[model samples]
Target: MSHVFPRHTRQAPPVAVAGDGCYLIDASGKRYLDGSGGAAVSCLGHSDSAIIEAIKTQVDSLAFAHTGFFTSEPAEKLADLLVANAPDGLDRVYLVSGGSEATEAAIKLARQYWVEKGRPEKGRLIARKQSYHGNTIGALSAGGNEWRRAQFGPLLLDVSHIAPCYEYRERAETETAEEYGLRAAQALEDEILRLGPDTVMAFMAEPVVGATAGALTPAPGYFKRIREICDKYDVLLILDEVMCGMGRTGSLFACEQDGIAPDIACIAKGLGAGYQPIGAMLCTAEIYAAIEAGSGFFQHGHTYIGHPTAAAAGHAVVSAILERGLVPRVREQGDKLAARLTERFGQHPHVGDLRGRGLFRGIELVADRDTKAPFDPARGVAGKIKKAAFEAGLICYPMSGTIDGKTGDHVLLAPPFIIEDAQIDELVDKLDTAIAAAV
Candidate 1:
């Protein structure tokens, strides 16, 4: 038996031997189309010569440099590029290894900002229920996924979880989409008041809920209201785009489409495009200035905080994203993908909703179409669909507990921006087959 620790101990996974474009080849020579980009990380696909060469050149020249002693060229360049393209007021980048680190840094940075501003009592954090930030203890504490947090309650910090802006399930029949968005956003205001706004340091949420809720896009005007609320209460707004940013949502930042910017944002996943492990937490100049003027330090870091090779990969990946005109291409191709999904599963008996923007789309499943009832959690609809899709040589992301962390199921599709029209059809066809087989 293999000694390696696996995510699922009962199953032995295939050894991936090679990656070509959007497909992965196993040791047995079986090819599986990467329909979900391996949890939406591979935006440029597997065989990008530019990124690979950048990584090689960086390592050959200078790979390891402690951030405390010296700043590397690639890290500086990557930070500049990210800040240049980031939302307004987000001018600083705290580089980390992956999504969890980015989020952990963001949380700590928020707390530090409050302390530096001479309001140490503003230490409380607020996150939305059914949202996912990351898996590290601090990140997990900030995330509101009940299932992921159940076993670790003793170690978690006291963070408040308000209702997520999941309009499909939470919006009332009498409300228009815009009205529902404002109403949903009102939960943040309610939580702030309940916690005493003066005690709250920051409010964290995924601009588009990923992982736990499967690309649950916020209702129209939801984030705008959220921004206003944050500003009104002196609470910093933090948007976690680990799974939906870096052109995954057809824009460099998913919040761009919502016409708002956060005081702090955490991004990874697609930043290095699976070429290297890298994530970054960006904050407004005001937050940075607080630390600069007060403590002259943030008082937190990791050993590999600014790995040069990873920075080089992120720089090259981002350069390609912007220079190759992939952003607009993502919009064009995303429309095609959405149309194909609609054509294939819009009216299926088990498919209840098709939602999302850009290449990030989600298909929610239901048992009773009219009533919008979920399948029994014990049935494992999502798990069976994932297995069926993988066996059919198509890789997709399906998860249960989409609604309230226990009831709903959804398949998240986030193909690479380079996906072609023909490949879109192939993805949908394979998913249809898998859904039919599993459901």
Candidate 2:
């Protein structure tokens, strides 16, 4: 019997022994294709010698350095590399241990920026429904997924929740995609007004919604209008790219495709490529300058915020992504994967919508395709699909509560950027088998 606390107490999971490219080997030598990159973290596959060597080199010299006293070379270089490739106006990086820490920092930074600017009343945040930022108190409060916050209601901050820009289910038949996007974006403006724009500090959202909503892509013009609204209201825009950024969406930053930059952004997952646990929160020059000029300190940090070894791993992973031209490869392979999914499940009675961009994709399962009705929660469709896929030597992300946090299901695919054509075919074939067995 093992003393380790697992995610689910009722079931015993297979012991993963090793990773090779896009596949994970279990103790029994079962090779399971890493179809979801272990929650979209491993973009360079599992056996990248370059990243491993970088970690080894850094640990040989200095493994860790507390940020309260000094900063390491790897940390400085990693921050510079991230800001150099980040969206416009984002000039500084606040390194953290993982996605939750990054988002938590973004929230605190937004609040502090307002206080420094003499707007102490601007402490409230506004985020869209069905979104997942992170699991920390601040980040969880900013996320609008009801199921995640149900038990922690009293501890959550009072954040205004607005409707998501989900074109598939919310868009009317009369409106065009662009029109629907604008109408959806209007929710932010409406919420700001209702909450008194002066009281709102920032609006946070994922560039491409992940986890809670799968790879839900924004409609055309959605984020551009959102940027305009934020500017008009003096509210900061914070884009959470924890799961979709770092060349996973055919761009270094997922917001690049939307043609707009945020005042602050959070990134993780692929930042360390599974070699190390690292994340960063980036802010505009103006925001950084505000804190620098006021208290000279942001007033928030963790012991492992700038672990030197993790920084070295992140630097190497990012360098590999850019130097090897994986961003363009994501686009090229993403198109092929999308085409294969369409060809296989386009007309399937149970598959409702196929959507996403780059290598991130989602397949919403529905009982009635014509009506877009979801399967009953009691049926456990998503859980069954996940089990079937894993049993069939595949690892995919299938989650329930995709629609409103309790009523829908979706299978999210985010294969490593190095996945080949043969692996793509294998993924689709195994997914087909899983869906057929589950639904």
Model 1 per-residue lDDT at 180? 97
lDDT of 1 by residue, 360-428 (tens): 999999998788999999999999999999999999999999997789899999988899888898899
Over the stretch 1-439, how does candidate 2's per-residue lDDT look in tens digits?
9999999999999999999999999999999999999999989999999999999999999999899999999999999999999988999999999999999999999999999999999988999899998899999998988889999999999898998989889999999999999999999999999999889999999999988888999989999999999999999999999999999989999999999999999999999999999999999999999999999999899999999999999999999999999999999999999999999999999998999999999999999999999999999999999999999999999999988989999999999999999999999999999999999
Clashing pairs in 1: none
10 residues in a row with least lDDT, candidate 2? 159-168
Kindly report the root-mean-square deviation of model 2 from the true structure over all alpha carbons: 0.6
lDDT values, one for every candidate = 0.93, 0.95
TM accuracy, model 2: 0.99
Model 1 segments beyond 4 Å from truth?
Answer: none
| TM-score of each model, in listed order | 0.99, 0.99
User: Residue 190, candidate 1: how far off, in angstroms?
Assistant: 1.0
Total colliding residue pairs, candidate 1: 0
